[model samples]
Target: MATIYDVARLADVSAKTVSRVLNGDGPVGARTREAVQDAMAKLGYVPSNAARTMRSNRSGLVGLITGAITGAQESARPFGLPDLLIVQGIQRVMASRDMTLMIADTGGRADRVPHLVRTFLEHRAEGLIYVAEYHQQIRLPQVPDATPLVLVNCFDDAQSPAVLPDDRQGQHALVRRLVAAGHRRIAYLTLRADMEATPLRTAGYQDALAEAGLPFDPAIVRIGYQSDEEGEMQLLWDAIDDLLRLPEPPTVLCCGNDAMAMRVYGILRSRGVRVPDDMSVAGYDNHRIIAETLYPPLTTVELPYAAMGMKAADRLMSLIAGQGREEPAPTLVTGPVLWRDSVVERRAATLQSISL
Candidate 1:
């Protein structure tokens, strides 16, 4: 209940001195600062955040909206949750700046985003970040001119600033590594045909093959995954069967993600196929739980989710600081390829060209 004035009186200093010490707006003598602190501790006084925000003319709040499922709901999507990591990244940067983050989960509903954004604006949030479940495009309602908005893992038709994974580069690097390891006949089991990553990654796959002087064969690449759809086991088996049945069966199978890789592990074992022996496997999104737990740890690429979150926050903060109104260009973050036990060196004996 003790006010700043009371602390000042007790410390034998002017209220202005106390205000300076509390806000750090101006320098106070070391002795004066110590005395002020001593008095505050004795009086059990706490500075009012509301008053500080009012004086500074800032809400000290950053708004974040995500379409992520948490806790029990997380079971619905076991692939790995990058949105959760992205939120953690954003919170880390915000905390360092002495700012508070206000988060809202849409539970996979994009329709609720505009309403949520409006509510944050009403609360005087200085900046806003929108996070999607994956790298995809979205359409958002109009935002005020003064507010700075940034997108994470998604972009909009309005050209809002965005931070996204460099799927092409990541996949390119992975495929190049596979080729270096003597994987001449590599097969890619792709994700949903509609998602942005599917095609970009496919392009990367081709780029590597072209560079390696390896022929690009359409039959080796197949649509292997989809979102919110069942019957994945059938699709995966069909893809695997097609790849292995080819007279020139691939030595390596590249999967869309670690979850798929996990499924592939089971499928290959069921068929009496040995990993890194009869076949080598790789995946994207080095999701540790899925990747590391497999019999032979998975060789995969990082999704750079945390890095994307940091970049988006930095961009939003820059915009808020009056750095020129940047024409929002999508900023891309690259993922590194992780080599692990799931891949084995191809020997000359296993490199024979089989006739179909």
Candidate 2:
């Protein structure tokens, strides 16, 4: 393994000069830089990350800690696609900047956050990004006053920057579409009310109902855990049964995610109910499998995972570059809706029945 010393010997420059060139800490003559580059290429010299951190106290590495709840019995893993997309975006930006990433999964292990932050600090990470599997309020570990930090799909104190989807706007848009298709008795199946995204989406549901002059029926709103598939299925089944027994059941069911929607689809199918024709369904996060492969494709909101990741990385980089100003503010991104085959115009009889 070629080291910085090897490159220095080949380039006939002091190790400090090589370090300066690598860290961009000081200017090196163009010819000198070219010689160093040439030597690096010839020797297959890979700079020692440890030495670089020692010189500048900057790791040139970013830390991404994810707090995803994989054990939940939900329709799907909540953070899978968004986390992947965010990482892709972050990598896109980091690659251009010659930075590397160190990712850690917390698995909802909130207590380990302080230790994780310390570990990244020991590694001399220039910045940190904390990603939550779902949008929820989080209490972050106490970090160094100088270290730049950002949050993805979650928020903390006003001092840190965060980037997440605009759930309220996305849900509102989805509900409006259902109303346009003449769906009045709309039901919403959501995660626990305590979850951050749930309230935002629930607010959107109410907003659409108000706009359409439809009465808000609490009975049609159901909430459950997001931890596992069996629990999710059971909760959804119970919600569906309750909704079906209503004097006039909803013609539209809007789910918090593709996972839940898929479960609902299975329950409905098993009960001999046809999709769209019998009940229109929509969901958020637009999980690829559910959107593309389901018997009746799902209409869903596409989370701007990549964009959020890119923005979060950019913001963190800006902070690291000393370009950040004032305390960090929460950032929200909006994803476009993907229309699919899961929804249809409410039949005249269905509409009449709900009205009666």
78-166 in candidate 1: lDDT tens per residue? 77545788888888898888888999888677788889999999888999999888889999889998999999999988888899999
Tens-place lDDT per residue, model 2, 184-265, is 8889988777788888889988998899998999999998446667787888888899999999999888888887788888
Residue 143 miss distance in model 1 (angstroms): 1.9
Candidate 1 to truth, TM = 0.90
**Per-structure clash totals for the candidates:** 0, 8
RMSD of each: 3.0, 4.3
TM-score of each candidate structure, all chains considered together: 0.90, 0.82
Clashes of 1: 0
For all candidates in order, the CA lDDT equals: 0.88, 0.82
